[model samples]
Target: MPFLTSPVLPEGTLSRRPQPDIPAAAGLLLRPWRPEDAPAVHAAFQDPVLHQWHVRSSESEEEAAGWIEGWRSEWARECDAQWAVVHADTGELRGRAALREIRLRDGVAEVAYWTVARARGQGVARHATDALVRWAFQEIGFNRLELMHATANEASCRVATKTGFAVEGTRRRALLHPDGWHDMHLHARLRGD
Candidate 1:
């Protein structure tokens, strides 16, 4: 493709800087996933609700460690950013949040998150998501961010709405879950919004 505009944020813009722990809300934070958190990651995957949506099992602490290592690598490569949602003081893992499908030239990415069974009703996902959106847009210069989930995921829809990601539309047969193809809702937020 012929060149038009430069990348909105240059390569290494994110990777070169140390990823700081972002305070999500009272008693919560978004921090880089650590190898030591592998056990918690594995445990969270055991939750049927989380596993149902993710459709992947950690299987063992070793596999969970691999996943955390990969997340670290993605941050270093500026390909994607993933964080562990945890207690600020205790460092207990509560969930996860990520900016996936990154497009540096377009200044866009998709948001993804899941919470532990014990943390589901405690606002972990919502607070973590709100903090991540602020960092992605205000601090990191993403022009827009998208949140997508199966139409049946009402909890996710609520989080999206509360975070100001307006419903753009629904995509037909967009994702394959264990139950087969699912229509997905595409929600988005612009920097100015």
Candidate 2:
């Protein structure tokens, strides 16, 4: 079951919203994506490490520019909330992270994210995911949050564990990876679970 076909989409935001001016983390921040970020963002995708973990196609300068524009517009529309990984001390864009598929049902939402290859294993994804989870559980009032990763993505599995997402179980062939259907490891972190 590709997440794209999941009934979850029906319960989540299908539009955009006014962009929030989020700062980098208190110690490490994850701010909203910006147009000026295209250059570095374009370069970041060139990292082969990122390609192996990310499911999407590599980007060109134009694509990166367009992506930034799209996220900005989506932010204004309240459809998707996207953010950039930045160093809290210098405020430099290190990568990008997101918490998507937000569904409001019985006070719960699911979260997902990625970081530039260079930023992996540096606690970048953890900080960014933590920020979003905090917002969903605290600010957004969601009581439960979920995450799923392809079984082959060991780094993601590690990230989920490090960030407190529990190993829920494995869903055989749950996602359609580039090659074909792949099993996925389901992980979750609830408000009081």
Candidate 3:
């Protein structure tokens, strides 16, 4: 079958190239997740805040390792991109940043991130998000990116706004958390923004 329009990005646009290590402000680097980071991944999920927002926890190191492998597989298939936000000098895992739900034909993806407790006040999430926002538009050829957070997640809303994602309004009860459904705030940025 023939299509009426060309894909916004070719299918292999991401998988054909190496996932670059993105540099961010505040001495952070967004690097690809590695198998060795399983322990840290497990530890991070243990944080109450992370657990609450993600609605899932790593039950064991093996489970965390599987998660890491899953991320790698996604990258290879160009389905999603996940990065470990780490300290540039010490290489400590500070957080995670990702482009989830990528649609090459539409040139869109949803941006996501989380900062560990140790990195909360130091602007890790903002820096990582800014870096990803730039990379997605400038380098990867995405036309639009969406960032959504539970209406109750104020910090995430701030990061989205600071990074230039304008609020598009709320998605009532879009995300379900441990406590119940949450009204989600949907924010978006265009490549031209």
Clashing pairs in 3: none
Give candidate 1 regions above 4 Å deviation.
Answer: none
- Model 1, 30-134: lDDT tens per residue? 999899999999999988897567668878999999999999889878889999999999998999999998888889999999999988888888899999999
Better structure of 2 and 3 per lDDT: 3
Which 10 residues in a row give candidate 3 its minimum summed lDDT?
A: 49-58
User: TM per model?
Assistant: 0.97, 0.80, 0.97
Candidate 3 lDDT tens digits, 1-193: 9999999998898999898899999899999999999999999988999977787888999999999999988988888999999999999999999999999999999999988888887889999999999999999899999999998888888899999999999999898888999999999999998
Global lDDT of each model?
0.91, 0.70, 0.93
Candidate 1, number of clashes: 0
The C-alpha stretches of model 2 lying farther than 4 A from their native spots are 1-18, 21-26
Where model 3 places Cα greater than 4 Å from the true spot, the runs are none
Cα lDDT of model 2 by residue, 1-193, tens digit: 3543434223334243344544545466777777888888888878776666566664587898898888766654444567877887876766676655555444555567777666667877777787777766655556677888889899888878987999989999887756788798999998755
In model 1, residue pairs whose N, Cα or C atoms come closer than 3 Å (at least 3 residues apart or on different chains), thus clashing, are none
